[model samples]
Target: MPRFAANLSMMFNEVPFLDRFASARAAGFEGVEFLFPYEFPADELRKRLNGEGLTQALFNLPPGDWAKGERGMASLPGRQQEFRDSVKKALDYAATLNCRLLHCMAGLVPAEVSLTTATSVYAANLAWAAEQAVPAGVKLVIEPINHRDMPGYFLNTQAQGADIIAAIGSDRIGLQFDVYHVQVTEGDITKRMERYMPVIAHMQIADVPARNEPGTGEIGWSYVFHRMDELNYQGWVGCEYRPAGDTVAGLSWRERFAR
Candidate 1:
């Protein structure tokens, strides 16, 4: 079976953010990931993780003033300084939290910038991030979020993500391949997983059509787990989905896959 991490941001909304570490551990998760840790002080989050004996599996870098609808600024032309500053801040938190992977969101494209400019800026930003992350013992990752969940998201497909990785051409950065997003954008889930396994740094899970627990949708998670083993994917598979009902009650899929 694949090693699983509870996405505390989405998985344990029943409790406060800091308290979700204990909730996740109580529910048998060995690791945890979340959207952002910038709001919480690094020491405080580290204390909770130490108390629960959980590993910080993953988290995204600051996505530029999220409340204002700015998802990220990486691909934006003039915000390069802000983007680099976020990477440094994230590295500080990752060092304290012992998280090796940090995702950098490519915010939606601006109407003023051409696609070529955005792509060039994206690659340059990623190259700078890789330069920083390589020395910090962290991996910088980018994910292709399905456009349905995030319309106008700059990066919206594995092909696009792979291209970015290729352009950067560094080991310190990789793709955060969310199965649900791939399924939503492209149906060849397992084949794509295998095809891009080399550049895949971290993976996330959510069933398609509903973006809920596995059995609630059509994904054959059993086969996915078995295939992951066959392909030797040695990274955490994050449970980044909303629970259909209660958080813990909808964990029958975990029970089924927890070998």
Candidate 2:
């Protein structure tokens, strides 16, 4: 079975991040992921993870101002310096936690920016970030968020993400394939996962139709999990879903995996 990691940012709402680490351990997760760790002291968070015996599987590099209409700009041209600076700080933070993956944000694709130029910038950014990440044994990951959930976001297709990875051609850089986003944007989860598995460094999941717990929505997670098993994918499979109600209240579905 694919190793499971709870997405602490979305699911552990009842407690602070550090406390949530303990909660995740108590809940039987071997690992956990989050959006941003910038808010807390990196050392303290690292201590918490070590104390809880949980691994930091994935987390995003800071993306500016979602509330103020600013999204990530790692792919936008003329911001190479800013992207480099961001990754440097992210590297420092990831080092504290002994993290192996950093999700490089694609941010919003400015209408004024041409797609070709954006792809070029994104490719360059990945190569640069990989240079920083590889030495620390960290894999820099690029994720494609769906347009429906994130309007104006760039890099929405698996083919596009794969092409960018191919262009960059680095073992340290790869796609952070979130099955929920790909299912919403591209549909064929199994075939797409199979097609991109070679370049995909990490994976996350949520049921479709409502972004709820697995088995509570339309996507056949059983088949998806079976496919991953068939492929012998030995990596973290993140439970990155929005809880339909209280997180613990909606956790009965986990019983299916218990057996």
Off by over 4 Å in 1: none
Q: What TM-score would each prediction reach against the true structure?
A: 0.97, 0.95
Candidate 2 structure lDDT: 0.85
Instruction: Please give, for residues 1-259, the per-residue lDDT of candidate 2 as tens digits.
Output: 7788999988878887668999889888899999889989999999889898999998988787757876686888888888888898888988899899999888898899998888788777888888888898888888889989888888799898888778777487788888899989989999998988999889998988788888788888767888988877778988999899888877777667423
Q: What is the C-alpha lDDT of each candidate?
A: 0.91, 0.85
What pairs collide in candidate 2?
72-107
Candidate 2 deviant stretches above 4 angstroms? 257-259
Query: What's the residue-level lDDT of 47 in candidate 2?
Result: 89
Going through the candidates in the order shown, the clash numbers are: 0, 1
Task: Give one digit per residue, the lDDT tens place, for model 1 in 1-259.
Answer: 7889999999888989999999999999999999998888999999999999999999999999899899998999999999999999999999999999998999999888899999989889989889999999998989998889898889988988888788777486798999999999988899999989989989999998899988888888888888899999999999999998899999888778645
Error of 2 at 74 (Å): 1.0
